[model samples]
Structure formats: C-alpha cells, structure tokens
Target: MRTASPPRALVIVVVVLAALLGSAYALGRSLVDGVPEAAPSGGPLTAEQPTAPSTGPSASPDPYQQWPAEDGPYGARSTTGDARVALTFDDGPDPYYTPQALAALRAYGVTATFCLVGENAQAHPDLVRAIVADGHTLCNHSWNHDVLLGGRSRQTIQTDLLRTNQAIRAAVPDARIAYFRQPGGAWTYPVVSVSHELGMMPLHWTVDPSDWRAPGAATIAARVTAGTGPGSIVLMHDSGGNRQGTVDALYRILPDLASRFHVTALPPEL
Candidate 1:
C-alpha cells in the first residue's frame, strides 16, 4: 500500500509507546513467574499435625528428681546429721488400733509421724487431736488412699491435696502438717509440686514393713526392726484394713527401734 508516510515525530511517538508497553509486559511476567520458589516438600510452610502431651506413667519424671532437694528426697529417706530415724504410720486414726499404737509409742517415750487419711481424720477428730497431743507430726495422705493419684493433672492433684489438708485442719485447727505422703508411695511431679507449694515436704519411706497386708505381727516387727537405721523413715499403717497386727508389731518393734535409733517423729519444719 503506497500511501503518504506519517510525520517523523508521530512515528517516534508510536515507537516510544510500543517500547513502554513491552517494558510493562516484561515486569508483569517477572512478577508472575519469578517468585523465588515453592518451599521443599517438608519445609515449614507445610501443614503439620499437632501432637498430644504424654499422659502415661512413663512420662513421669524420675522419682528421685521429681521434688526439689530443699523440700526433701523424692525417692530416698531424708538426710540428717543426727542419729535420728522417723517412725511413720499411715492410713490412721482408727478408734480401735490407733489408741493401742499411741499407747505403745507413749510407753516407749517415742514420737512418730501419722499420715492420716482425710476421711478418717474427719471421722475421728478426737483421734486426730490425740495424735497431735501425743507429740507426733502430721502428714496429709490424700482424701482416700489413691494409689493412682500421681497420674492425675496438676489441678486435680492440688484439689485432692487441698481437700485433705482442709479435712486435717478441720480436725485440728492448729495442726502443723509437716509432710505429704502419696498413697501407696505412688508419687509424681504434680503431687510433689502441689505438696511443696502447700508447705509440706514430700515424704518417701526408707523402710516398708508391708503391715497393710496383715503379714503377722512378728513379720511386721521383724521387717521394721531389720529395715530401720539412722535417718530411716519406717512405714507402717494404723488403719485402712485390720491394723491389729500393726499395733501389736509396734509394741515389739519400738523397744528395739528406740534403743538402736533415736526414734522420733519428723520435726515440724523438716
């Protein structure tokens, strides 16, 4: 098509517009195609499934490390400089046998720690007062004998411990509870932490006589006598089933324990 050529300025303007359009297209292409890259298959941008916290017994801390050292040993008996050992009775304040246990301790001029069940303490406030009157220390043993209490949550453990402490205070308003014993010796961090916050030492026994099994008075006495030593915390039961054997064993065991070790209750503060 032979037609008159356009003006040079017009031609220049057209060329300039075409160049600008091409530059814009290039920028748009770069923006669309030049993102650094997609993250690799396992990169952080990938969606991840959440994991649940462990709730099994295996998740628990080492029994010895669960509690702070200032609070006391978690798995072993408390260390003391003196030649003193603690005689501790659990699940107590029984109307029938507690009196006998108390009498035996008194006769020997020995003091012991009584880890009382909250319900029993509530039921036998007189016995609870009697325990304190006898110069024995007090320990909270939970509302009931919950062997699995260690596996519970912090809030649940706290509630259980607080209720027991409340029950104990209800019995003896001015009682000084020095220790907390997990039922069946099933201590966990949550239980220990709760007890520490509540101003009670987590008590673990060095000697267990298996008195709760009613394994004859002689057997109980033998176990206690054999197991006791300086700084030993001997575990016995005054209630939570037939504890007559325990009461009888105490009479036989105390004379020997008193002579061998300066048997006494755990001090109020320690």
Candidate 2:
C-alpha cells in the first residue's frame, strides 16, 4: 500500500524550523570569526585593549636636518676655527686715544682688528700705517660713521663703501681690507650684497661692551670679560668721542682674556 502524505501544517512548521536553524548557525560562525584572540592569561582581547602609538627614537626629528639657509654673506669667523678669540676696535685712529690703545695692545702683544671710519682713516694715515705695521687686520667702518648708510640706495652704499676702502688703502698702499662692518651693526641685504661684490666679508661682533658710551673702565672691563667666550669677536671703540675708559679697560681686559683664551686678530684676508 502507498504511504499517506504528511499534513500541510506539519510540512510548513518543519520548513520554518529548518530555516531558523540555518540562520542561527550562520550568525554563530560570523561572531566567532569576528572576535579577536584573547590576550595572555585569559585577559581582555587585543581589540578591547586599545593602546597609544610608540614615541621612540624613530619619531624624533633631527635638529640639523631643517637648518635654515644663510640669507647673507658669512659673518661668523674664528681664526683657525679653534678655541680662538678676536679683539676688534672700531671708529679708530683718534690722535688722542688711538696711541694709548695701540700701546696697550702692544704691551700685551695681542694683535687685533681695527674697523676704521673712512674720514678718520683719511685724516690719520699715519695711524692706519701703524695699525698695519703692528700686524693687525683692517676693516672699513663707512665714511662719517653713518648708522643709516645701510638704508641708502645701492649705488650710494656702494660709493660709500668704495670711498671707505679707498681711504683705508690710501694709508697703506697694499692694505688688505678684507672685512666691512656696518656702522651700528645695522645690516641690510643691499649692504651685504655690495660688500660681497667688493670682495669684503661682512663682519659682525659677538661681544659688545658698549664702551662707546664711555661707561667706566671697570664696567667695560667686566662686560668684555664676562661676555667673551671661545670663538668670540669682541667689539670696542677706539674713537667716536672720549674713549679714555676703553683705553684704560684694555689693561684689565687683555691680561684676563689672554690668560683664558687664544686672543688673536682676525685673518686680514678673506
């Protein structure tokens, strides 16, 4: 005899139950695949334990890598690039104080760089010769010590610098004016470019005693001695008013500086 067919409700119920079971198995497999492995000692999963990024050496930036490019001529120089210090006197060759300053330098046997004012150099060619004779370097300090010279037109600046160099050269026919120091340390791009065109290095000082104001000898000596370090270029004035304090301070400064550093003049040639 042929078997009887199952009831329609029973067949429908079986189909619905089979579909529900299939869905549950698929969902269970998906959850298992999605879950991260447990951490050591049955701790929380790695996905649950979020951590910050490491900050090790590889993350740090190199300091010298992004160093800024020089915008003007090289102004920093030290003799032989060692523990050397340079003494520079500006606006010099004064009839009254230049001799005393020179004598002080001579007594200490220390050669120095003298940035001479063009007019002053023109007036005292003898002193200019004396500076060179003493084996010191020569620098041009502009005509009349114009602090505003850097702001003038390029042609005017050039003419002023040329005139200054001419004055310096007139003193000693073969004088090597390898450096140009802007009066008041006011440097402009045009001034720097023109100085380079004239084959002169722009000179800048590291230590400034402000002895130009004739702040007492002791104060000037203190500032000079305290500010100076290895590879330093010191600025002092031998002229531009009563510089008697500077002349006297040299006695204290030279001995102390000589004892601590290799005090020498800047190279006369660039």
Candidate 3:
C-alpha cells in the first residue's frame, strides 16, 4: 500500500528551518549520527584538557585508549555539559499529517528527527527528502512495523534494518542514518549490539506523549511541555492513526513552549 517513486528522483528544495525553542545549555558537541548524548543533569565523562609538555614523550601511552567515540563530546564522547533537548517523530511520512507536522516544526524553527519506516519512505520519498532539506535528521525505524528483536532470527532483524537503511539512503543520498529506533521502541541486547557494530546507535526517547492513542490535544500539549527539559528526547507520532490531533497539538505547543523556552533540535549535548 505504497506508491512507487517516480523514475526521476524528486529534487528537493528544502527550506532551511527548525522551531526556535530555548536551550537549557549551550551546544558542546554535535550528534554522532546514531549516538544519543547524555542529558545535562547526569554526570558524564568529558575530554581531558591538554597538559603541559613533559621531559620526553609523556609517560602515558595513547591517552585515547578508551573508545573515544563513546567518550567524545562531539563524535561519541560523553561529557557533563549543558542542558539540551531534541524533538523526534516516529512512524511517519503519512501523506496527510506528516507535512502538517513538519510545517509546525518549521514554524517554530526547531529541527527534529524523523525515524522513518522503509515502506513509508518508499511511498513518500519527497517528505523524507524535505526533512533532510529542511535540515532535520533522518533515522531508521525498520523495514516494516514488525518487532525486529523478538520472534525473529538475527539475520531477519538485520535484513529488516539494513533494507530500511538502503531505502533511506537511496531516497536521500545525504541522509546520515546513524540512529536506529527499534520497532515499538522494543529491542534486545543483541539488537543493540548488532546495531552499534553496524555504525548505528539505538535511540530511546525520554518523553513519550503517547499521541498514537489519540490523546486530547491539551493533554498532548501538556505532556510535551512538561516532559521537555534539558537533554530530554520527546517521542510523538505523525502516522499509524488519526494524527490530526497530533498536528493540532503541535501547532499550539510550538508557540507556547517558545514563549517560555528555546524550542531547539537535538544534535549535540553542548
């Protein structure tokens, strides 16, 4: 139940935009494709400052002994920096509602991540392209809506994930899909391990508004407003159900959150 992409890939004229929300802390580092950053409140390991030159080569071996990525402030480094937050959408590219959601995001000047399903991406590559064009990040959800970790072989899960990656990359060659959100946010240790080895990190949302259940607009707004804080990842949906409520709530929430705080996107833990 998806549309085939036209022979000519749509040339995306993405307008540069994201919702301009407040930031609890300044950006210390950018997002590493798939790796999520530590929230501001938690204690994190940061980079070591340069020490003065010693007599001969410093007594220490390669100081970068640790997997620098998991420790880097920018790449994979973790550090106790400033407070930050990111708004992310899942199960999207809904022909009707996704664009509305994107418009809301654009209106507020906040960038977000769209965890795309393979079939959805194939059906609506233009929207995916627009997400990238507008400067938002693209991440893989799965090839289908199936729970990849459970009731399946490792090869099955890998096939589903990799196929989605290929689909996204084919649609938007520039799409840097380093993040993977398991279907239903469900994942086994093996799934996470394989994902990391595959150059992606598992993503977990800190705040889930549960808009999929069609919660009232006011309630959704309240949850989004309350859940939002430093280093908080908010989860909302644009499809898989009646998303009109989601769209409406997003419009209202944007200005309200903007008046009180900086409605920014997540890329760094700065």
Candidate 4:
C-alpha cells in the first residue's frame, strides 16, 4: 500500500479558502449587525438628534441605522457601485505627510478620512481642523493608541474614546466625529462596550497596505489595488511611522481608483 500525503498546493488552497471564508463571515456579521439599536433613553439617541440624521422626510429611521457604524473607525467601507469609496489614513493629521497628502487629495478633488490619535490631534489641531475644512472625516484612533483592548480597564478605554471625541469637537465642533478604529485593530470584550458607552462606532479595515513597512510606492499601490473592491476599507498610515511611501502611493492610486470607480468620501449616513 502506498502512503498518502496531502498535496502541498491543495493545502495552500485550503488555507486560503479558510481565511477568505473567515473574513467573509466577519464582514457579513458586521454588516448584518451594522450598528446596534439604541435603547429608548440611550446616551445620544434622544438628546443628540441633530447630529444624527432622520430616516425619511417624515419617518424616523433607527438612529443606529441612520448613521451606520460601517465606516472603519477611520471611515466608511468602499463598495463596488459606490461611484467612489472613501480613502482613509490613520494615526495622522501630521504636519509632514498630511499637507502633501491633502494637496494631492485636493488636486484630485477627492476626500478622505483621518483616524486621529488623541496625542497627535493635540499636537496638530491645525491639521485636524484643516482636514475637516478640507472635507475629510476625522475619527478616533485612541488617546495614546494603547493596546488597551486586550488588557486595559474599561475606564481607560472609555477615556481614550471620550477624550479624543472632545478634542476633535474642540477643534471642529461641527465635525460629527462618529467612528473609532482601535489601535492595531485590537479589540476585546470591553472594546465595543466602551465604544458604545462613548457614542462611537468601532471600525476596522478590510485591506491594509502595510505602508508603514515602507514598501516602495509601486508595491504599496500594487497591494492596495489588488485589494480594492466594494465595501472594502483600505488602510494606510499618515503618521506613527515614516509615510512618504504612503503619500506617494496615494498619488498613484487615487487617480486610478477614481478613473475606474467612484472615489468619494463615505457619507455619515446614506
């Protein structure tokens, strides 16, 4: 009798399928659950109506539904028919790269989202305001980009979310900052709970260019382009590491993405 062994390619194929399926499950669950419905007397539901949108001219849609928590803390999911999708940068509002990034975005007539780290926001409020003035979404990345999700206290996580919200509110009070992308995409039992406590929607990326690795612009663009699709949230960084590669890739991909698809900012609501 011949001994049987698993084919190497077959194993690889099986692994890829499993990973893809797992991702699909997460995406489906997140979409199906979108944003949780608020209780009758939740924090912002009854009191903070204006910032939230109503369903129709006459009907009141579920508040959570009105502002779907679909934006990957950094911004909204980029989908196929979306004429254009949101282009989001995390850990930024930096002086060096953001100005260049903004210039490119402005030149292309496109918008983006910036998931601001609290300390960075404090350090660069001008850039944050400019981001808002320039028509980009400002989201929370955390006060310190802590690994708080895995082990920190709920109070600490809440502080991270609430403080950043306040900081953004101070700079651009009109900017209805609604999303929270955890540091390293880290989450735990308290992550969503604390997020809910502070009136933010947790966000994560479906595609990450890992531009922080300083992958040359061509490679970065290639990775991102390979992943572009509907309901996809592409992750790039503007700060927390050298980001010239990210800036360069943005210059290349923005025009290409716009040419092939709708490259617009994700709306706060439908």
Q: Using Cα atoms with residue i matched to residue i, what is each candidate's TM-score against the true structure?
A: 0.73, 0.72, 0.67, 0.68
- Candidate 2, pairs of clashing residues: none
Off by over 4 Å in 1: 1-67, 70-82
lDDT top scorer? 2
Name the runs in model 3 displaced over 4 angstroms: 1-82, 148-151, 268-270
Compare candidates 2 and 4 on lDDT and give the better one.
2
lDDT for model 3, on a 0 to 1 scale? 0.71
Question: Best-fitting candidate, measured by TM-score?
Answer: 1
Alpha-carbon error at 260 in model 4, in Å? 1.5
In candidate 4, what are the lDDT values of residues 1-270, reduced to their tens digit?
999999999999999999999988877786799864444454555444545445567875444343444434323333423435667798887899989889989999998778898888888889888998888877788887786554688777776688888887777777777767788876654676567556666667667888889989999999888888765667888887788989988878988888876676556432
Name the regions of candidate 4 deviating beyond 4 angstroms.
Answer: 1-84
Residue-level lDDT tens digits of model 2 in 1-270 = 999999999999999999999988877887889964334565754877666566787777643333222323333232235579999999988999989988999999999999999999999999999989999999989988899988999999999999998998887989899988898988876777788778887788878899999899999999999998887889999998989999999999999999999999888875
lDDT of 2 at 3: 100
| TM-score between model 3 and native | 0.67
User: 138-211, model 3: which lDDT tens digit per residue?
Assistant: 77788877774534776877888889988887789766786777777666655665566567756777678889
lDDT tens digits, residue span 1-270, model 1: 889989999999999999999988877876889763444555545236445568788696654464546423453234433678888889987899899999999999999999998888888999998999989999999988899998999888889888888888998898889888899877766777788888888888778888999999999999989877777778888888899898888878988977777888888886
How does each model score on lDDT?
A: 0.83, 0.86, 0.71, 0.75
Q: If ranked by lDDT, best first, what sequence of candidates would result?
A: 2, 1, 4, 3
| Candidate 1 backbone overlaps, count | 0
